[model samples]
Target: MGRHKALPYVHRTFRGWHVRRTWVNTGEVSQLNRARIVSAAIDLIEREGADAVSMRRIAADLGVGVMSLYNHVPNKAALLDGVAEAVLSEIEFTDDPSAHWTDRVRAQARSFRQIAHHYPRSTMVVVSRQLQSSSGVIPVEYALSTMLSAGFDGREAVQLLRVFIAYIVGSLLREVGVTPTFAPVRPDVDVAAIDGGLFPVVASLAGELVKCDHDEEFEFGLEMLVQAMIVRRGARASTSEPPESGVIPSPGLS
Candidate 1:
């Protein structure tokens, strides 16, 4: 038998090879989604107020194209909503089921202040818009539920929740120097420059007021608000039912 010569195999080749597009890892892409965009916006807001939080600005901050942010945030309104949600979502609900309702209220209030302090400028986004999404509404729902469980009726609970929100938002805004309701104190004017002859009380207290400790002031106001709530709760209870044996009802109730 004659030995057959082995032929070398020739691999086929095509001209003009197209390069495969490189892609970011799934983990990286996921990390760069809504959360990342919202974080960048929050940073921008904290650094330069909410007015500086444009999609283009955030994209630039994140080193991405402006169009890339649209994938996560559709428009400026939605972006603001995202920022608001981010701010409100930091308010942690009370975890101890057996905690007193008043204590829970205090906890929520403190949590709100802490988060507001963390994102001082961005927190205005929370007050400027009504949250429609479930995630955004969780804090409100939790607070209302707490009020209702404490024996307040639905209407009372809703009103009380609104009052708490208004107070907290106003306090935080004032701390950030964005007082919309009244004239903010001009930091540039020296307290000693005020005329004691013209405005005696204002001049007298100017030193103390100008140098007041905000943390102490905030806690003092919070205690007053909590005490008022306690009083309201007690009044509601008094008016809610007949006096027990040997307990005389108040004149108004009687």
Candidate 2:
């Protein structure tokens, strides 16, 4: 009988799975699965920004054929969604029922900042996508629940949650040098070269403007938001009395 040759990669026909093996120092092999694929996508995003994330690029990073990634990711949009979920899963949520609502909110926000700092370039994937997966929705559910427990009605809680996410996203975008148009910030301009006559204040604070302490500024904004929430809850409590008419004024102008 002739000897059979072992293939470098394998595809199981029964389950329609594609698997790749890589040699390790311990002589064991690691299988490339959806998790590994998503991780490679995140690595690409971190190194080359979100635009670099593609099935072919991730497959190259993982040392596999481009078609191999399709078995797991299916398409580019699914791949990006996976990246967002993976990054969000890194957040260590503190949902201690005994903790004060404000403390819980602060803990979640701080944890979010840590993840943002860890993946400055890839974090935007999370911000731009609506996280429908469990991993991404858990943090949001925690935030909404905290707001509700702190005495916010359903609409109020949703609106407050949107503002909270906006603050974090805006801060991280600035830290990562991404502008409103999603382009990288222009290289530092020479403030001294600017026309002092036209913009006196910008010239005067050039020293301070150039040396920003992002951490300190982030904390300042976070505390201000928290305090404002506290004040709002107190005011809502005091105004619990019903209006003469059942009509509740809309939250904003049409």
Candidate 3:
């Protein structure tokens, strides 16, 4: 059928799910099943990432029939929520909100990096999952609670959380080649063939170039982001005056 005919039914189905989400007051039993499937999903994702997880495979791995899964999960999209949560919870972060915001943020960012290290494919899921599920929101709250306690308003907290997490996770994704730890290079051709009259700087700097570790490099960027955020927070606090009454702020001018 054309989209014009399909659209109404699609909208109604989604509207129906919003009501199904409230089934049984809360998803207590479903949450417990999520705990199981998510555990298996993490292993599958580590081997193949977010795409590797399917209700069929997860149910098989858990030794439960596929129909049994529906009692706990709505569909693959909902199961993805569980997988993302399991990946997030793998990071061993302390939950005490009394810690300084920087310290807590450091821990939060580090934990996410650690999770991404193990489940590289789920990196996409970490920052992108919807908050309708409690599992998906817990780790986010872990980070936001620190910012909230640090006197950041809601809007600022969300902006910084996205910025910081994306910067850190994006940096980690760039280091994918080395994370699972590959073996040394085995060139198919003579190594000296490509060395004809090389750029002197690169030739002379071979030792330093070979010694560089991207994991260490990724951490450095995360450190710089944290420092820059701290500086921005301080600068905002030190502003001499607030905007004048009735003045509308222009975008991208600051």
Candidate 4:
């Protein structure tokens, strides 16, 4: 009778798996998985741009067949979703019941911004995609819970959250120099050539205006929003009338 052969041993790496066969010296064979594929896609995007990321490209990077990636990612849309979720996972939400909700919100915003800064090229993937993963939902739910616990009604919480997200997206876009076609031109203009008499303040501070400290600006804007939320919460507590039948406003309603 023929002896039974042992199966290959699998070694996982951030990009993929290395399969080692004991029977023969086939060296390391690549096996694709969800995490590995998503990571490779992110690396590709960071090194090149979002346009550079594709199943074919990722599979090539992993030294695996393109069809092999389908078992893990299924399709490009699903792969993008996975990539977004992976990016979202980097945001660390602290579980501290004792901490003030405002502080918690501030921390969450800062954590998000830090991740954005770390992955500037890939940040848009997170912004553009609808988050369906638990890793993405958890932080959002935590933020909403914090606001609700601090006495924000459902509508207020949702609206405030939208505003916060908008601010972060806009700020990150500016920081990363990714703007729409209609965005103000950022060309190197001659500040001295501009007539000071026509635009005295802008001309005088053109150098300072151009030299942006994105971190400082983000913090300043976030603090402003936080203060506004605090004031709104206080006013709502004092002056807002209770709804009929204890009904909370639905976020879906206009």
TM-score-based ranking: 2, 4, 1, 3
Of the candidates numbered 1 and 2, which has the greater lDDT value? 2
lDDT of each: 0.69, 0.72, 0.61, 0.70
Model 4, span 1-254: residue lDDT tens = 33332233334332222334345222332344686778778878889988888889998987889998888888988888877777766664455667777787888788778888877777788878888667667667877887887788898888888888789988988876776321224565555567889989977876665566777878899978877776566555745433323234433211
Which residue ranges in model 2 land beyond 4 Å of their true spot?
1-27, 180-187, 193-196, 238-254
Candidate 1: clashing pairs of residues = none
Off by over 4 Å in 4: 1-29, 179-187, 239-254
Q: What is candidate 1's lDDT per residue for 83-168, written digit by digit as tens?
A: 88767655544444477776778777887788788778877788788889754666676678778777788998988888877888
List of clashing residue pairs for candidate 4: none
lDDT score at residue 19, model 4, on the 0-100 scale: 31
Residue-level error in angstroms, candidate 1, position 169: 2.2
TM-score of every candidate: 0.73, 0.76, 0.63, 0.75
- Model 3's C-alpha root-mean-square deviation from the true structure amounts to 13.1
TM-score between candidate 3 and the true structure:
0.63
What's every prediction's RMSD, in angstroms? 16.7, 10.5, 13.1, 10.6
Give the least accurate 10-residue stretch of model 2, judged by summed lDDT: 6-15
What is the full ranking by lDDT, best candidate first? 2, 4, 1, 3
